[model samples]
Target: MSTVIRKYEPYNRFKGYLVENNIKQREVAEVVGLSVSQLNQKLNGTRGDFSATEIRLICKAYNISPLDYFFYD
Candidate 1:
């Protein structure tokens, strides 16, 4: 079998959380006060890091710890 690789490994855990929770990408973008494309760019590592406030808002909206999504092994 061929191995498939993801473009955004750093956010893989977060992506899983979103999927498991049935959270939509547009909702996340709204919560973070960003456009969907902008959010995608950030998640894809094409853009730089998210601002502190953006992270806080996302965590608050989802009631998730940053470590669970941002900091990964």
Candidate 2:
């Protein structure tokens, strides 16, 4: 039996989206309906996971798709 290992791709678009939108972290928090500290935790990689509802809220707030955040080239 062979164990297949895949490289882990972190969810990194939260910051990118903020940058592209010219939004500050505080501003992103407001737009995404999250607390500043919570958003910071996510951006700083302290939070290990984002709920599906959180993902949807972010996508809806930013007018993007979940695929846009999670997919890689």
Candidate 3:
């Protein structure tokens, strides 16, 4: 049997996007209809993953593609 190792940090990409674009977490939560605490939980990996609607709203607000949020090198 063989094991595969991956070095992907899922949420970091989103965090990086926010930092790069100067987007505030509070504003994003408001626009996405999430509570600031909820957004923090999601971003901090304490809560579950973002819903599809939330993802769409974040992308829309930042004028970014979903790909940018998920996969940035």
Candidate 4:
């Protein structure tokens, strides 16, 4: 069975936050413990799959609650 990925707007929001903070994408990748290329791919929508650990890391990095990043309709 195929897994359905829910829409998560926080990725864009998070990117904006990073830019607003003058945080480089590579810096964010290092801070979030993700590879720079991997993070770039994710940001570009070339990768839509992320692990639970990644989600937690992202939330931690952005200081946003996990629940705030996601919703299902």
Model 2 poorest ten-residue lDDT run: 3-12
lDDT of 2 by residue, 1-73 (tens): 9863423434567577777779787876786678899777766656645678777777777788778775557
lDDT (C-alpha, whole model) for all candidates: 0.82, 0.69, 0.77, 0.67
Candidate 2 vs 4: which has more lDDT: 2
List runs of model 3 lying over 4 Å from the truth. 1-10, 71-73
- Candidate 3 or 1, higher lDDT: 1
Candidate ranking under TM-score, highest first, comes to 1, 3, 2, 4
Tell me the lDDT of model 4 at 54: 77
Look at candidate 1 and give me any clashing residue pairs: none
Candidate 1 lDDT at 40 equals 78
| Candidate 1 local lDDT, 1-73, one digit each (tens) | 9764434444767778888999988999999889999887777666766788998999999999998888767
Of candidates 3 and 2, the better by TM-score: 3
Candidate 3, poorest ten consecutive residues by summed lDDT:
2-11
Report residue 25 deviation for candidate 4 (angstroms): 1.4
Best by TM-score: 1
Local accuracy of candidate 4 as per-residue lDDT tens digits, 1-73 = 9864544333665566667889798876886678999887676556665567877887777787766543223
- Whole-model lDDT, model 2: 0.69
Looking at candidate 4, the ten consecutive residues that score lowest on lDDT are 4-13
Instruction: Give the clash count for model 1.
Output: 0
Candidate 1, overall lDDT? 0.82
